[model samples]
Target chain A: MQVRKIMCACGSGLGSSLMVEMNIQDVLKKMGVEGVEVVHSTTSDVHPGAADLFVVGRDLADFIKDVDKDEIIVLQNIVDKGELEEKLRAKLEA
Target chain B: MAGMAEMLKRENVQIVEGVDSWEESVRVAVQPLVDQGYVEARYIDGIISNAKEFGPYFVICPDLALLHARPDQGVLKRQLAVTVLRRPVRFKEEGPDVRVLVTLAATDADGHIEVMRRLATMFCDPDNITKIAEANTADEVYAFFTAPIE
Candidate 1:
């Protein structure tokens, strides 16, 4: 889907979201996928076109229901890089 | 801001037998930072209020939580505290059991990004999580965080 930007979000945008953003950047680097700008912010900042993809923890998944399913990645474990890399690979490939 | 090891002082790390509820867990987690003056007493309340509003958004992974609130809530300086519960606590009726609470007090939105990055590297490994959770002393927990990332 040619994702150029990914936004990782949490309730406050200070802690968990930033962690996910870092993991995403690492995964992207390992995957050799360049040009994707991974950023972190509060859930309130999520919206259509806010980014090519919106990633959030499972608890906060309900908050981003307005976004398209294909553009959303709901993480069961916000700190699980393996889960993130697997799901992100699927999404990027699909 | 200091690195994760420097930001989390030895005195700020603790191992508690258990807590009655997740609220108590949050209180225990942030108490060190509060006592050290990194955050105002109300900062604890801020985290609880935020959890009530957002539904334990800080439980970043199973057995671990990074408790925090907005910068303006009551942050005096950016710092961290670790509370290891011998018995795990749950933030929700069906949420994952959380045993380690890493409380963060950031004075701004972006100031703690590097610290969070180091934490990301550590906590991503389940072994590291277990190492801190099962730590016998505050020094052990402190050393786990302060140790060079392999």
Candidate 2:
């Protein structure tokens, strides 16, 4: 909600992030949220102000927890609809 | 981009439950692709190696693990294989027990985006995953992917 772009990341950037991106896109669509771009990236590709939100797996989230907690969305299960939707809803409603 | 339903053909699926360890699970998951020349033997090594290095970050959910490495490591093509164990295996100490293994081989960074999307759609739902976990045939499980997303 803060930025139009949401970055989905993993270790190598290309693999699992694609899957998480897909889930995020689907959830955002169902939420009627539009114009938000989901960027698939790796840890190396992420930096300050690189994205509006950083969505990553729990392991990688531990590394990024120091970043803006508001922008960092850590997922225990990348594909869980409830988890993804709830986090996005909280951030957007805030 | 081949959707997951297309990439994960009936031939590429294995339902041999109760694999001894996570290592054996990955080896069984990707062996079909290796035999068909879709991926190199080292692709298996790449998955296991990455899991060791990253501590099963591939364990995407409570019962699922999607394993992969740099496509340049050993991928011969953009493809994937799925293996559902009879019971979950501990991938890491105190981590999630994984029963489903998805070994991914992409030709390049973006090569498998659509396929991954389909998988994300299929596995995202707990109900769908429950159906898949109980499915006895690849077609039965794959039906979940081909079904129109609601």
Among the numbered candidates, top DockQ falls to 1
Residue pair clashes in candidate 2: B17-B86
Task: Give lDDT for model 2.
Answer: 0.78
Candidate DockQ values, in order, are 0.85, 0.60
List TM-score per model, in order: 0.96, 0.87
Instruction: Give per-candidate clash totals.
Output: 0, 1
> Of the candidates shown, which would achieve the greatest TM-score relative to the real structure?
1
Report the C-alpha lDDT of model 1 over B1-150, residue by residue, as the tens digit: 667766878899899999999999998899988888999999999999988987998988889999999888999999999899999999999978999999999887788887888898888788989989998898888888888876
Winner by lDDT: 1
True lDDT of residue B31, candidate 2 = 92
Model 2 ranges with Cα > 4 A deviation: B137-150
